[model samples]
Target: MHPPAHGADTPLFIVLNAASGRRDTDAVRTAIESACNAAGRRCRIFLVDGPGKLQPFAREAVERARAGGGVVVAAGGDGTINAVAQATLGSGCAFGVLPQGTFNYFSRTHGIPAETEAALQVLLTEPPRAVQVGLVNDKVFLVNASLGLYARLLEERETFKRDYGRSRITALGAAVVTMLRGGHRSWRLRLAWRGQERDLRTRSLFVGNNALQLHQVGIADADAPEEGQLAAIAVKPGRWWSLPGLLVQGALGRLGHADDILSFPFASMTVKPAASGQRRIKVATDGELNWLAMPLLFRVAPEPLWLIKPAVAPELEAARE
Candidate 1:
């Protein structure tokens, strides 16, 4: 589908996840309303009750946007954004974000401001640009997908947040405790791409759609997913003690220089259990967890999603090339 044109007259339907991040729903609603008023645009905010409500609300918003030829904004974190984006996939309705989540990775990767007011201003002023999306089976993900250790970490982190309150410190503490408990295990898988197959054992497998994230993790320097391929990084099995060193390398953007990491680009790939009887595996996509039937299919969508980005942002300007 062609990119939808956005303007001052374009109606904005924002779906806000009340439980996202640290910001309360009322404050977010106030900020969005204020910004829309200042920009002289008509806006509607839908405060979602929970994760279960996001999909139906987002779908309705997309339907309305398509009928009115406007934009549907996901005003929460990556998970919320992914839910809204899934609805806009082929509708040709522009997708926007307010970036009210912790990391705001999708927003940061796209050059959308992390601050509420600034992000709203950008959405008001910028035109929508078409950006590629990655898919695992029928689900859409904007950032990355992973299996094994990273998935386990996310599960642990969520539980910790639910019990102790959510914060970066708590997340780090959860990671430390979870790692110490020693739950990670190696997986033997057969990876197939371009008619070739190889059997390998790895602690984790990451498939990234955001080129910036890949580069930051020292995996690749891809500027866009428009190349119609996903960047895959494999962490080979290693001693448990080496996990800390691997984490440091990733943080320092030197993961590519490490011996246990393997990185490559692929248009499509299949991951299956090396053993014949194994048929299901847990996968985390853009921080949301799910179980998928194996051999899992990973591929780039044939069409790109239209994203509203700032007209002039430093990160976006650098990515344009």
Candidate 2:
């Protein structure tokens, strides 16, 4: 879909996740004001307290944008982006990003700007790409939802965040200590993709639309985190020591080694307990704990979510090229 041309009078809505980042919200406001004024675009700025606030505000923002055919910018992390996308789906109000969250995985993968000034510039000048979106159960994710060890990592980090105020070093130390303690748990995963079904024991399952690319490890074939497909990569842990190797292999895209680790493409799947009435696994969407359900049903939404991406790092761009 084509973005509306930025005519002389297009209105803009800038939504920022107030709870995000280390910088003060006042600083964000100043930058936003400066950018919008410089671009000669009339704009409104909203500091979203959390994801839920975006839904109602999103409709109003879209309607307002539609009144003048303007754009709505989701100015936070992936969750903020996902919330705005859900609200503006098919509304013709192009979605933009400000990228002010930790991980910012979606932004990083899509080449969204890392610098505030640069990201703001892209918002004014760059056209967005219509990209695929994934669904966990019925909920939408701009990035992939994951289970298994990574889910555990999120849980641990969250607990640490409450206790330690998101101290990065403390969180990292906790993750390492948790891993070193051999605290990983294995579960029986019953997956049904399309018509086929398989019951396997695994320690972790990662379902992603886009592959995750890291600097030292090259690239792994994660489903494009923003693509519409759900790529499930799983690891079966007979022992705790098996994980480091699995992780390394997964990072290198060599998921074939671990019989416990399985990677498959799926449009949709219903996950149920290996045994009836057993809740063996916890599920996470966009790094937040979604209540545990036996037999998690997952799918892909056919339409793409439009996103404003910043430029990628030179090395990553070269590789993609």
Candidate 3:
């Protein structure tokens, strides 16, 4: 797929999730409307009021953008961006993001501003650039995907988010509580990658697609994703008391030196649950939860999403001129 070559007059089909970030939805809508008026571009807003509405809105955005040579923009967090990107992947339309998520890993990794105000400006003025996306059972994930204990952690985090609100600190607290009280049992699974298959016991299996995230977590081969490969990390069985130390190591960017962590960089991986009858399992992609049929496949997507990158700095452009 190629980038959409439309100018300022190109319409913007926006998918905005109402509950995504800390920003007021009405304020965001007003800001976008005002910006579109100033730029003399059409802004069509598709409000995602619920999770079930996201796919329909994303599909609508892709369709409208493709029909009118416009750009499909997602104004939310990483999960929202992932959903919209899934729709725009092969539609030959450009994708834009207004980062409003807690982590905003996908936006941060690509040099997009985390603030909604600055991100809005870039979404409007920047040109589309081809960017890599990872696939889990054909579902697009821009940051990371995980199974087993980590997916359960996300569920616990959501419950805490509902009670205490959303933030990085809240997420950490949730993780701590979940690990302290939740089950510490390992999963019996089979992994097939790089022409070899192995059965292993793990508490969590995480596949990372964003280089910045992996690097921040102290993965030695984090750059593998940028080089057209995905990075996998399996949490080996260890005492429950050791999990906190590993978490601290991860936060300190020293997880690469940990003994309980196993990392692999590969082109693709096929994962199967312990029994054939266990056909479906819970998975989390970019922090969104779902149940998918196994054996799960993780790899780089064949097509690229045309992402509108940051515009060149005005001073640099002026110097060139």
Candidate 4:
């Protein structure tokens, strides 16, 4: 393996989101400080109040790193990490994550520990490796992006969390309630994949950048994030009663066997309204929702981002071979 691009002299800039998840900010900050101190790494932590400040703070960190060649660590959930990672793109700054999210899918996919201290240790000592990033329109996502039903589910999940509380159980409940409430809606989509164009009606379209999630959900058997491809799954419109069976298949890692689920790999694709004159569509990238102009362009970024991973990451081992 190549030596890490940054060394002891390279300062560590941690951009933390104070409102991420339900973790106590003071406790997380203390843990980060303790871990960095124990690792003998010189670090500076910047805490932001909300998403509004995350991007600006991350951009500043990137500028600092570009001047001196350092690591910029995002110390929050996937949203926080996505903001920082997007800023670090093309800047040649090593991106690190201190997982403080409910899923931490991005961090876990790269073999970073969920615990603050252990993840810090990896951030302080490990080398940054190149990892593929997924792009929808102009936004970059480290995990997955989707349209239709999955997007609605994410939106409902957030609403549930805001009104009730955040937890895995609550998320599951939200999914169930969302489905029961007849939230799944079919889209007449014109999809261009692998140079082939097709018109299809589907309830959900998921493009996964994190191979681990694809495998875990049984959408794909191979975890090949470094292979320069995105794993995509589309669900055919079906009766509401069929949703549970599909869910079961996913949970059992057999989603590929389900008739309604279509799985494929693609370097890029175009998704837009099949009907004429429709100029906008809603997309959820890494659980953040937005309405983008029609004919959404999704692609694997031309250049991979340099992401910090644990020295002993199993994913890294797999990538090496």
Candidate 5:
């Protein structure tokens, strides 16, 4: 693998969300500039106006990074990372993170540091590793995607996040309120794979590329990135009681092991709305929620993106073994 030259003084693009984490970007920029100057690298700062502006900022950063043969660093939260990742896809440009968001799920999952100094150290010391990314139709996600009840819950959570910051309590409150208000709804879901298709009346479907622990309790088999397939998990809840059972089963690792549950590996799956004249369904990808039309195509891109991450800690790798 040809790594970006060391100490070669290449340019680095820094994308920042000024209001992220209630952080003071001026201070962060001062530190970054000092560090880059000492390492013989240069840095540029771009402050995103708001959530919607991240996409344009990301595209501009990708173009600049390509022109300068440099790496791009998203200096904010998961939303910022998602924007940059979408732009950097298939571009052969390495992506870096500066974890300035609330959850910072993508950075935390990949073992990227949140502290400015340590994160910068990783960018300087480690080579980028190719990581697989998930795509729902034209949208790219580094985390997971969900439809049905979870998607609706995300809509409420967005308001909560805007009012009150992210916390387990916030999510728990939203879930409880949503459930009490009969938030779960049924849909006719048809998933096709390997020339075989299965249709079911289901409450929701969650497709994830990484083994995610929800509510700090559940574990799903999402470990193999090189498998060249996305882990397709379909949850069908027949009743209100059965709905909560999905979460319980997910917590117990029996999610794919139960009769009511269906779990398998597939390269792609598409969601078609069952209701007539329904133009779109709510969907959340990597915590970025939006609405898209049915026949939503989700596919595995097979390790298409490369991220600069710290070397795996020995204990973590050993545990995996």
Candidate 6:
């Protein structure tokens, strides 16, 4: 493999989100500082104390990375990682992750360790490798992006997490509660992809850019993301009730076998919400909700994440999974 973009001597600009994950900020900060000091590597920790500060801090970290040939590292959940990645995507600087998220799918999928010490070791020593990214309009998503019912579900999921605490069980419970509450809204969507245009109705749309997630969810063509493409799953119109069943199948790792589910792989797609004068819509990218302009264009990002991670064969990913 090519030599790692940065060496052990490169400085690190870590953007730490105090709100992400369940870890104690003071403890994590101390660990980061101790590790960097021991390695004799320059490390700067930019604390993101609020949502409003994430983008600004990330931009500042990117500037630092550019100035010192340092690596910009995100030290938080997927949302925090997404924020940092938005700034680093095309900045010609390498990016790193210190996964402290409940899922940490992006980091675990790349073989980054969960322990703070191990993660810092990789950040300080590993080479940079390309990882696929998905885009919804201008927003960058590392794992997945969604809209309609799924987007609303994410909003509800956050509320549930705050009350019930963060866990896989809590997430599943949120899904069950959201479904049982019965707010399924269908939309007439015009989808144009691969030079073909088709109209369809669906209650939710999810686009996945992480092959590891697609595979874990039992979506066929799970390798699409690794092949410079994206995989999408849509809830068929009038079949919103089937979502619960699909969710169960997903938990069982057999979601692709279900009927009334629409799944496909595409390099690019244009989705027009067939509503009159509705240009703004809510989208959830990597679990962060935002109001994005309509005619959502889902495509593979022009650039890849320069992730500092370990190399492993695809079949060996079972351990990481």
lDDT (Cα, tens digit) per residue for candidate 1, span 176-264: 77767764799999999999999989999988898667666666545536477888888888887777677778777788889988888
Model 4, residue pairs in steric clash: none
TM-score, per-candidate, Cα-based: 0.93, 0.83, 0.94, 0.93, 0.86, 0.95
lDDT of 4: 0.83
Q: Tell me which residue pairs clash in candidate 1.
A: none
Candidate 3 lDDT by residue in tens digits, 1-321? 446687888899999999898889999899889888988889899999876899999999999998899999999999899999999998889899988789988887777887677788888788898888899999888999999888989989999999999999999999988888746779889999989999988999999998777877788877777788989999998887788788889888788899999998987899997666778889999999989999999988887888998643332233222
- The lDDT of model 5 is 0.72
Error of 6 at 198 (Å): 1.0
Q: Residue-wise lDDT of candidate 5 within 1-321, one digit each (tens)?
A: 454433356678888888677667888888788888888788888888666788788888888988888888888877678878889887768888888876666676667777888888877667777677889987887777888877777788778867877665776667666656764678887677788777878777777766333212232445543367677666667666665555556556555555666666778776676556767878888777878888889998744777888756332343244
Q: lDDT per residue, candidate 4, 1-321, as tens digits?
A: 332377755688999999787889999999988877776877888899865888889999888888767888899888889889899877877888998989888887789988887887788777788888999997898899998888989998998999888788888888878777764678889999887999989999988998777777766534646578888788999887788778778778788899998878888999888889988778898888888888898899977788888645665345334
Question: Model 5 off-target regions past 4 Å?
Answer: 1-8, 212-220, 224-226, 241-260, 274-277, 313-321
**Between 4 and 6, whose lDDT is larger?**
6
Rank order (by TM-score, best first):
6, 3, 1, 4, 5, 2
Model 1 whole-model lDDT (C-alpha atoms): 0.84
Candidate closest to the true structure, highest TM-score: 6
User: Which of the two candidates, 3 or 5, achieves a greater lDDT against the reference?
Assistant: 3
- Tens-digit per-residue lDDT, 36-153, candidate 2: 8988888998777765776677677778877777888888766677777777767776778788776676676676676788878877876666766777766766666778787888
Spell out the clash pairs found in candidate 5.
none
Superposition TM-score, candidate 1 onto the true structure: 0.93
- Candidate 3's C-alpha runs over 4 A off are 311-321
